[model samples]
Target: MRHTVERAMAAERSRYRRFWVAEHHAVPGIASGSPPVLLAALGARTSTIRIGSGGVMLPHHQPLVVAEQFLMLEALFPGRVDLGLGRSPAFTAPVRRAMRQEEDPPDRFADDLTELRDYLDGTGAVTAHPVSDRTVPMFVLATGQGLAVAARLGLPAVLGGPLLESPDLAAALAGYRRDFRPSPRAQRPVVTIALDITVADTDEQARALVLPEAWAMARSRVTGEFPPLEPVAAIVDRPWTDQTRRRVEATVRHAVAGTPRTVRRRVEELTERTGAGELLVTTSTYDRAALAASDTALARIIGG
Candidate 1:
């Protein structure tokens, strides 16, 4: 993954806006648990492309600590750091136990966001180390009430998952914009939609590219363990139960995968529907080379 991001993504630096890593603790399928640590490595390897978290889950850490880590990142990367925050709980009960998270933690995300911003903007009661005047632009990984929080705080929202395909998506975003209160960080509402998108030479090839991740998703649902991605041939050779097959089909159906023209058309429709200013491609495949190729094709399709 690091190799692909360092060489493949960095190679197409001009065609991509940002390369964001995610935070997933104690998930067998995910290797990187800390976004800031991974971001530091990725930041050192690439120079131009912006690096950030898809996000750092705010429920897992203190707001001041989060600010200090990203501030340290800004000190290292200068203008290339962005902080995308989320309030997702741990992946499972065991994971939550491992993180020492409360069984029924109350939502303090809005307050944490305020505290984090204060530290970043140097308005906090206590100073965070390596503080610089440059504000590391913040974005919320929003869904449902998350959107409302983003609007009230005057921050950009990074929306993904079922919300992107929700029937009420238009109304939800409309409400966000209508209720948005401009802050010093942002004078207007900004929305960035994220989803799995794959581009290949042909529609068939694109579908094939999505198989590994789709199979993984199906298996995770059944086994309660999100395992490492398998090769397409390996996935094809294995026998799948009817439920697994249904889940795999459903996942593939949700993913945007096809030739450049096909992907372009769907993307245009999504942007038109959401009025999103940015699209964050979250494509994952067992084949690293294919993933890179898809990213390249997507960059061209989006005229990046």
Candidate 2:
């Protein structure tokens, strides 16, 4: 995980301003379950790339804990840290119980987010240690009600890759921007769409690169177990159920995978349609090198 992030930083240093890691618990297919630890390490290694959580699942943790961790991260890296919060429930019932004995009530997210921000800014009844007045810019991993909450808080919204493919995407983003209420953190709304794309020398190669993770996503929904990604060669040889095949194809279709030229055009259309200021590329192919190469191709085409 460290090596993969470092390679990305090295290759994208001039092309991108920030690097973010995600949090997933008890998923074998994912390695980043602790964003604070990972981001701190990344912050220590690189001087310029802004390191942050793509977001921390707020429901599983206390607001004070979240504030202290990111405050320390901002202190270590100073002006190059961000705190993106999320509201995803635990994966399974048992996991949910382990994280929160009483399931998180959806209505509490606003209060939770506000308290976290206060703790970071030293406006809470108590203050965070390693004292610094600088506020770490906060963002929301927008999904479900997250977009509206972000707007109300006047924080930037990070729309997920799946949301980018939704039919209502343009309208939804417009609404978020329109309804946004200005706050001390931000006076205007900002939108950043996260997208899944793979750029290879040929369309076939790019399609092949996306198969492993897409197939894994389908298998998880069909079987209730999100398994680790498999090589495309191994996946193609295996037999599939009619149901599984349909599900797998549906997931893969959400992605834009093709030669660099095709990917560039598609991404430009998406940006124009959404009016998003930033595009967060999330290319997840099984092979690390293939994923890195996809990023390289994209950087060459549009990174400048």
- Candidate 2 residue 195 Cα shift, in angstroms, is 0.4
Local accuracy of candidate 2 as per-residue lDDT tens digits, 1-304: 7675566477546466778888988778888889999887787778877888888989888899999998898888899998888888877777677776475465678899999989988988788877787879999999747888988889999897667777877777877988899988888998888888898999889888989988998887766667888889999999999987887787667788999788988888988988888877788877878887787788787764
lDDT of model 1 at residue 205? 92
Candidate 1 TM-score, C-alpha based: 0.97
Clashing pairs in 1: none
lDDT of 1 by residue, 110-212 (tens): 9999999999999898999888989899999999799999999999999999998898788889989999999987899999999799999999999999999
* Cα error, candidate 1, residue 237 (Å): 1.5
Q: Which pairs of residues have clashing backbones in candidate 2?
A: none
Best by lDDT: 1
lDDT, residue 282, candidate 1: 87
Residue 77's lDDT within candidate 2 is 87
